[model samples]
Target: MKKILILMLMAASFAAHADSFVKGADVGWLPQMEATGYKFRNAQGKEEDCLQILKDLGINTIRLRTWVNPSDDSASGHNSKDETVAMAVRAQKMGMRVMLNFHYSDSWADPQQQRKPAAWANHDFPQLLKDVYSYTYDVMQAMKQAGVTPEWVQVGNETRTGMIYPEGHTDNWPQLAQLINQGYDAIKAVSPASKVVLHLDRGHDNKWFRTWFDNAKAHGARYDVIGLSYYPYWLDGRPDYTLSINDLAANMNDMAARYGKEVMVVEVGGEDSQPQNTYDMLMAVQQKVRAVPDHKGLGVIYWEPQGARSWSHYELSAWGADGRPTKAMEAFRAR
Candidate 1:
């Protein structure tokens, strides 16, 4: 009896010292805006209503994407700068920390497409970097002015390729690092305490991360956190939850140790298109990550949970269409 009691006490003690990590969600640009009755979703839900749902699910952070000019029909009408700021304010009022994602384009900026902003279409390399810095600073200052200082800032979204288009490609990490540093400097200039995250995809590819981060470090790019995007369906042939989770935890630890910075699974989600499997995979990943040494595991943020609302113009698959607790959410909480 004494032996069992002592073992239980030890377990409790270890749990207390383990790093407290955040479980977050990105509301996606359009749906969130529509939820505010800004554009679509005529009878929009109140911001507090959505936040209350998240809070009930134990989510602590909110990520909002900002576009330069979303009014152009040729581009996907995502949240404009003002819309993003409004969301940030609402999130702050709900007691959620905000993560600002700079798309740096009038539309979606991802590995496949990174269309440059209209005003920056003709700017040269030096001028482009200047614009990046100024835009970043101005956004940060605006958020601060609204009393919604972002807790974290992503310089660019899914920048496995790069942002600002032709000049900021990943292969040219040297020049890209300089542009990223300019943004980092601007963030620090406005909010010295805010953490600047350099985001990338291909989280399972350890070699890709090693090479990319090593180059960024060598180029003296300053950033406070390392962010990764892990989508099992897209990367791995099928949803192999266990293997992907183990790989992600190991990769996160390896990168944190190698780069000497806290690592965040900034973006992670299973295909809502395959709800059951997606939930299972996400849960598996969360459980595996929880077992990793506390110091190395930052937290996991679901890319979008309420995507089924049909507000997003991207036509991506959503897991919440059935109005059920996704396996991913169940698995995440289980961890």
Candidate 2:
């Protein structure tokens, strides 16, 4: 009887997640934005909850990032674990699934800068690993207590050269792997159902991903999903050049075939002024991702769909000068 019940529960879990296409938005700074008196509006210019605005446009998932110990002002420091929980609770209440992104830094932890948290600045390799695990576990526990079960958890955000600074740089692949695995272990221990995502900055550069993942895999790092950040405008005029929709699709399909793991464009955005172009680009991204074999492409997430009203000062968001979502949001329903 016990075995039968266990199997039934497992089946139920699978059923709940089967064939899910995550139309997600990353509002990691929403708390900060709201605290600073930012308000959102719908097409009618009527005030609306930011989450409601996204849901109305077909977004089903919320991706939020947490900071270890942000020392910025109250609004800026809202990325803390406790603060993340509060935001996640709100998103969950709207029937939205959560994707907890751990930046692993006090401020921004991205490819260009992965500074060691001030508290761990002097820690040795082993101690740093422990800190990573502890921070991840504590945050997951907090979210659980808040009744927010993250559907996906990112170990590190835009970890192109790895996280936690020089110690985990590309040359120190082993150290990076250890840090990532520690985070992965903590999330699985606390929320086994949550998928772990290893994120990087470039969605079109398959070679960069191959080399990074190969190194991580060699060092025993494990993850269930590969998260990519694609910002075409930023890539323009770069040596490698930006990808068209077809290029993005090819790269994503290749990654799926090569790694055999599900993937998501965990971060994507374009110039807010070019809403029509933004809509077309995102529409292409969606269709291409869905074309991956066996549906390995989970979905694309707009980094900050709440830019109107000048929240966060992001110029690439899908919001308009009128404090309403632009045509860029139509990509989700473009099919």
Candidate 3:
């Protein structure tokens, strides 16, 4: 009993030390933007490496998304495994931690659509399970070989309804659990220290989160982190952060207590046109996550903060029209 106690205490100490607030950004569109000659400037109005600009803004972590057999289109393609490994190595060399998001699709996978990759379209249920495990392990192993392991690996991106469509859909809870577990097991196999995240959309919807997580528990889904995407601009009736900030905080607290898991606002952003409002929103969100009991709140990440609206036509980016980051980026520095 004494030996077991010592081991447990050591584990707790390690976990405590490892629990640092993660300030991150998902710059999945960065590589494409750069290739197309989209340059980024620092506050000083001088051209700088985009990663350095992010680092200067106090970003300690970088999130990259990977797709399977993507097309070569500039808008929707080129997050292949090779590119992901290269990006991971680059971010690690810049003294930043990395988070890998697996979309498990050829394009974006989210609440509206979770289409299977074309190669996976005709696969049977059993084969799809193997595919998930094999593909996940392959990318993880590539990262390992490249000398940069991610701190967090997401099994799927914004999978509110579920991923891989009908086969792994929430309609069949058992199968969805199995698919998630396959990715979880594969990630652990390659990088045992890495935390596996199960991500979903709509961070402020407590009732939906509870029901989804309850079903996850009942069906035996495994994940170390409960990742959420909190986008006020996208919310139907509630278009302001103030309207949902309290609910987001409560949901974070409730998820940590109920599931015994760490929670992270893995994806968040405000309108670039409203820099001050976006900055305020970011500050508020950070405070709420930091307030989670026992340091269970991992962190918040801005999705595509550097993807300027002029280039990507995305409104939620933190970058200004002139290629410099907007005031919203300062919130990370404030901490």
Candidate 4:
């Protein structure tokens, strides 16, 4: 009886030290994977679902991207509202937290492009805000009906400038804040506990984040979390970042102190050439996040570690050519 009690106490202590850190992955390609003849193999070389493989890696959260009525065969079309709910239900069944990413576009939305959905292309800024609010509310309502409440809802994906292009850009900060507030309010009305994230790429630049958030705060934009995208391999190529990994960690710390909001690496990837290097990058990012004052740095997420050379044509996947995840994924192991 004494031994059992000791073991129970140890488990509880470990849980308390861990503090609900999120090790997440964005597998937006899951449905399309099912459509193809591909199979994700586990460490034991047995055919397994991609998500199950991720769960085995100790990934506690799943992030899925959704589009605004994309046409069939488009990248965004594969991840419709039904697909988002399906993905969320699968993650929830595995006892994993979920993050819903609303791209607010019919196609890919990123720092380089933020096209207004064709259906709303003609709408003025005021009408656009209403559309954004309705779309966000509707998605949350559907997820709730499916018995899945997202732990986080991203208002937009990689919005370095502003969303909806010509209509709403950095030049017009007030309109941008209004549009973001609409989405923030919608998510709150549906799932009060679900934290809203304002996402941007470039995880290493402190100056850009300060400027952006300063503008956001002044214009009445509110959010619970700050989402960053860090691609170590792609960092040097971008003139704006040009930062080393150490710089990335410093940026995270500065964000926590400056914004007083939780920070997360919503998207990250490493080169597959050296699994150890990938592992190091993951650990490096995780350490910076966990080191944030007051535990506001949430965690790091691998963007598409399973996509590989499959349908996504993404080369940064941690999976080996032999159909198994490399040892790098073991970086997710609690230290």
Name the top TM-score candidate. Answer: 3
Q: What lDDT tens digits, residue by residue, belong to model 1 across residues 2-47?
A: 9999999988876764425667788755354444553211112323
Candidate 3 has an lDDT of 0.94
In model 3, the runs with Cα more than 4 Å from the true position are 1-19
Question: Which residue pairs in candidate 2 have backbone atoms (N, alpha carbon, C) closer than 3 angstroms, thus clashing?
Answer: none
User: Candidate 2 residues 222-274, lDDT tens each?
Assistant: 89999988888878664222345566777788888888899899999888888
| 4-113: candidate 3 lDDT, tens digit per residue | 99999999985764446889999888889989999899998899999999999999999999999988888789999999899999999999999999999999999899
Alpha-carbon RMSD, each predicted model: 4.5, 5.3, 4.4, 3.4
> Candidate 1: where is the Cα deviation over 4 Å?
1-20, 30-48, 72-75, 291-294, 309-319, 322-327
Highest lDDT against the true fold, candidate: 3
What stretches of model 4 exceed 4 Å from their correct place? 1-14, 17-19, 74-76, 238-243
Question: By summed lDDT, which 10 consecutive residues of candidate 3 come out lowest?
Answer: 13-22
Better-scoring candidate (TM-score), 2 or 3: 3
| Residue 172, model 3, lDDT | 93
Q: What is the lDDT of residue 99 in candidate 4?
A: 96
What C-alpha lDDT values do all the predictions have? 0.74, 0.85, 0.94, 0.85
Error of 3 at 335 (Å): 2.1
lDDT minimum window of 10 residues, candidate 4: 236-245
Clashing pairs in 1: 272-319, 279-327, 279-328
Per-residue lDDT over 1-335 for candidate 4, one digit per residue giving the tens place of the 0 to 100 score: 99999999989975764758889989887777777767889999999988889998989999999998777772446788988899899999998999999999987899889998899989987899999999999999999999999999999899889887876687899899999999999999999999999988887877888889999989999999999999867765742222466777787788888878899999988877678888877887788788888778788888878876645666787888777888879999856
